[model samples]
Target chain A: DTAVSQTPKYLVTQMGNDKSIKCEQNLGHDTMYWYKQDSKKFLKIMFSYNNKELIINETVPNRFSPKSPDKAHLNLHINSLELGDSAVYFCASSQAFTGIGEAFFGQGTRLTVV
Target chain B: SQQGEEDPQALSIQEGENATMNCSYKTSINNLQWYRQNSGRGLVHLILIRSNEREKHSGRLRVTLDTSKKSSSLLITASRAADTASYFCATGGGTSGSRLTFGEGTQLTVNP
Candidate 1:
């Protein structure tokens, strides 16, 4: 079974369109995260949720919002996506909120905004 | 701002050779983790070395951490073409609740 899975493996949208990506983890992890990989392959943590509660929020713009309905699911919604939003987004989960545990990552969703 | 910076932004090696990548971080960390990302796949956890530990080994992957220098190195022995991928070193600690700060990855190309 896939420990972590995200939908819409590839997404292409217009400049002003809005889109949402869904992520789910079956590892029974307590913390889930969203990371953005830019064209340079630099991975940056955008948001993190611990047991359905928002814990870490980076310097991301307000256009991107992460919602965790439960401990197993974390979804990302982007409002008015722009050209700069064209990048790969990955979903990850860890057994605990600490870094001692390894994180399981899902296949990334590549977003291309025209 | 990125917390870690990987040395030798890109590397090319023939199969059966060894690949070494270095990582330097800006702050104190509880632990350092290395991850690999294939051409179109998500990043996979390779190995981790704690701040107090000096070196660790997992199969052909060897990781070394130097807290005093705030630096780390990942060595992959007998690298194969399948090992071609971007390697990233991430530092986890600080007041952000175990949040990981990643470095710009090092792209390794293992040619057969």
Candidate 2:
């Protein structure tokens, strides 16, 4: 069984189009995160949810919104997507919100906005 | 802002040789972790060393943490072609809302 899984492994859309990426984890973790890796392979944290509650919201643009219906699922919705948003997004889960443990990551979703 | 910065942005080594990567962080952390990502894949957790721990060993991977210097190092012994990938060092804890801060990553290529 895949410990962490995200849907739409690849996404291609035009600028100004809205899209969403769904993520789910079966690792029984309490904390989940969304990260973006750019062309230079620099990874940055976007959002974090713990037990379905928003815990960490970075300096991300207002277009990107994350919703966690429950502890197992966290989805990212981007409105008015722009060319700068093109990157690989990864969903990961850890044991707790302390962030002291190792995390499990999904295969990642490669988003391309032309 | 990124908290960790990895040294030697890229490294190329022959099979059976040892590969070493170092990481330096800006702030104090409760723990540090090493992750590996293959081309077109997500990051995979490799090893983690806590602030109180000096070193840890897992299989052929060895991790050392120095809180005093705010740095860490990962050593891969007998590296193989399969080990060729981008290795990242991430720092956890601090006032950053429990988010793990990742470095730029080190691209390691092992020639067969």
lDDT of each: 0.92, 0.94
Off by over 4 Å in 1: none
Task: Name the top DockQ candidate.
Answer: 2
Residue A43 alpha-carbon offset, candidate 2, angstroms: 0.6
Candidate 2 per-residue lDDT over residues A1-89, each given as its tens digit: 99999989999999999999999999899999999999999999999999999988999999999999999999999999999999999
Question: Candidate 2 — which residues are off by over 4 angstroms?
Answer: none
Judged by DockQ cut-offs, is candidate 2 incorrect, acceptable, medium or high? medium
TM-score of 1: 0.97
Estimate the TM-score of every prediction.
Answer: 0.97, 0.98
CA error at residue A41 for candidate 1, angstroms:
0.3
Winning model by lDDT: 2
